[model samples]
Target: MSLSHEIMKNICGYSRAKYSTWFYYRPDHILFDAGEGVSLALRNMIYGIDHIFISHNHGDHIGGLPGLIKSRASSMGDITKPLSIYYPEKDSQILQFKEYLDVSIPKLPFVLTWKGLRPGDQISLNANRFVEAFASDHMGTLSLGYKIIEKRKRLKSEYKGLPQQELIACIKDLGREAIHEEYHKNLLVYSGDTMPLDVSIVQNAEVLLHDATFVLGSDREENTHATVEEACELAIKAQVACLALFHFSSRYSHQQVKDKIYEIITANNVEIPIHYIYPHFYPSDFKQIQIEN
Candidate 1:
C-alpha cells in the first residue's frame, strides 16, 4: 500500500495496450517494460538503480532504451557502475536490439553490461531478497517472469548480551543450543505475461501476481495469453496466500473486468483473497487497504 514497498504505477494499462508499461518495486526497484517516456519518469523519480530487466524485446518493452541511454550520458560522466540488463535470448534479438540502441545513442558515456535471461535463474539483491526468473509466453519474442523471495533473518531479541562466537560454537557442539531459529521465508511471485503452465514454481510464494488480460470465453490460446478467468484458475490451483491480477486488455474497463472475474469465480464456488491493481485508485477514492507486515 505504501509508495516504496509495493508501488505499481500503471504507466500503460487497458488503453490501446500498445504501451504496456509498469514500474513495480517489491524485491527491488524494477522497471518492468520501458514504454514511451517511461525513462523520463524513472529519471525523475526512481534512484539506486543500476540494472534493468526486460521481459521481451517488443517495442513497448525496449522502446525507452535510447532515451534512458541518452539521459545516463547526460547525467553522470564515466560512472563506475555499468548499466546491467537482463533479457531472454532465443537468438541474438536482445543483442541486436542493444546494439541498435547503442549505435543510436552513441554518446552513452557509461559502460553497459548486458546478459542473457535464462529461466530457473536465481537472482539475489543484496542480502535481503532474491529474484527467480522463469520463462513467459509472448507472441514471437522471448519473455520471462520473476519471483521475489525475501529471506528472513530470525533475531533472538532475548539473547542480546550473550556471547557471539561462543554461541555459534556451542550450537555446533550442541544441537539446538541457541534460541534463534529461522522458519520459512516469505516469497512473492510475479507472472509478467504468460499462458497456463506449471504452478509448482510459485508453491513457496506467499503472494502471486497473475496476468489476467482477457476474460472467460474470450479468444485465448497457448501461444497467445491468459484471461481473467484463466488467471483465477491458476491462482486457485497454486493456492498461494494472496493473488493480485494485472495486465488487463485495453478493450475492457477496470470495473467490467473486476465484476466479470468475481462473478466467474463465484459461480465456480472458489474463493480467495483477490486484489486488483487499480493504479488510478488512491486512499481518498478507495478505502485504505489493510497493511500487512
Candidate 2:
C-alpha cells in the first residue's frame, strides 16, 4: 500500500475558528492535539492511542486532555495501556493544564506520562519509526509541528550497477552492512495551528496536514494562522506528495472553501492530491472525503 494510505487510513478530525482541532491516526496509534470533542468523537478509539502530541497550549488545542484522561480511567476500554503525551517545553499553559488534570482526576488505571519536548526532540515509535518536533510560528505561543519518519535501508549507489553475482560476492567479502545505508523517509507532517514557516522542514513528505484557518486573503490577521493560498504555496514549495488543509475559519461556507482551494490549485498548476477538513461536516464524515489528484 502507498505511504499515504497507510498513515491516513482512518484519520479523522475537526477544525474551525475558535472551536476545536484534533487528528487521530489509527494506523500509528497517534493523536495530534486534544481539542474539545476528541474524547467524545474518538470514544473507544482513544484506547488505541499510545502517544498524544500537543502542538500548543491554546484552549482549542489542548482542551480535551482532561476529559480524555478521565475517560480512559473510568471507561470500559482497556485502562491499562500506557499513554504518553508530549507538549511544548516551558509553556505555562500546558503546565497549568497538567496540574488541572492532576487535581481533577487524581487516580488513573494506567500509566500516564507527560514529557516536555523542544523543537529538535524526537520520540521513538518503534525500532524503525519515530516522530520529530519542529518549532512553528503561531503568534507568540510556543507552538510546534510534528513529522513522522520511517527509517529504511537501501543498497549503496556504487553497488547499483553491479551484477547479481558480484553483489553476492560483495556481501560475502564486505558484509551486508558495508553495502547498505540507512536513510530516513518522511511519512507525514502535521502543522498544528501556525502561520507560514520554513517549508524546507517538511520537504518531500508523503502527506502534510497544514493550518488553513483563513480563506479570504483580506481577512487575515498578523502573526496568526495561514490562509488557504499560503497553505497551498507552502505545500508546493515543500514538494509534498499530498496536502490536507484544516482549521478553516467558520465565517466561510463549505462551498467557499472548496472554490478557493480549487482556484489556488489552478492558479499554481498544482498536481499533488489535495484534501481539506470542512467546518460543517462531522469528523467521521471528514474521513470519507477522498483526496483527488
Top-scoring candidate (TM-score): 2
- Per-prediction RMSD in angstroms? 6.3, 1.9
List TM-score per model, in order: 0.73, 0.95
Tens digits of per-residue lDDT, candidate 2, 1-293, equal 87775556667788866888999887788999999988999889899999999999989988888899989998988999999999999998899889888888987879999999999899999999999999999888899999899999999999998999999999999999999999998898999999875878888899988998999879985869999888899889989888888999889988888888888877778888788888778874553233356
Off by over 4 Å in 1: 1-16, 75-81, 152-186, 268-272, 277-293
Worst 10 residues of 1 by lDDT: 282-291
What are the per-residue Cα lDDT tens digits for candidate 1 across 64-175?
A: 7777767666664443446777778564776888778877777645677777768978666767776668888767567897776666656466655768886676568765
TM-score of 1: 0.73
User: In order, what lDDT does every prediction score?
Assistant: 0.61, 0.87
Index of the highest-lDDT prediction:
2
Q: In model 2, what are the clashing residue pairs, if there are any?
A: none
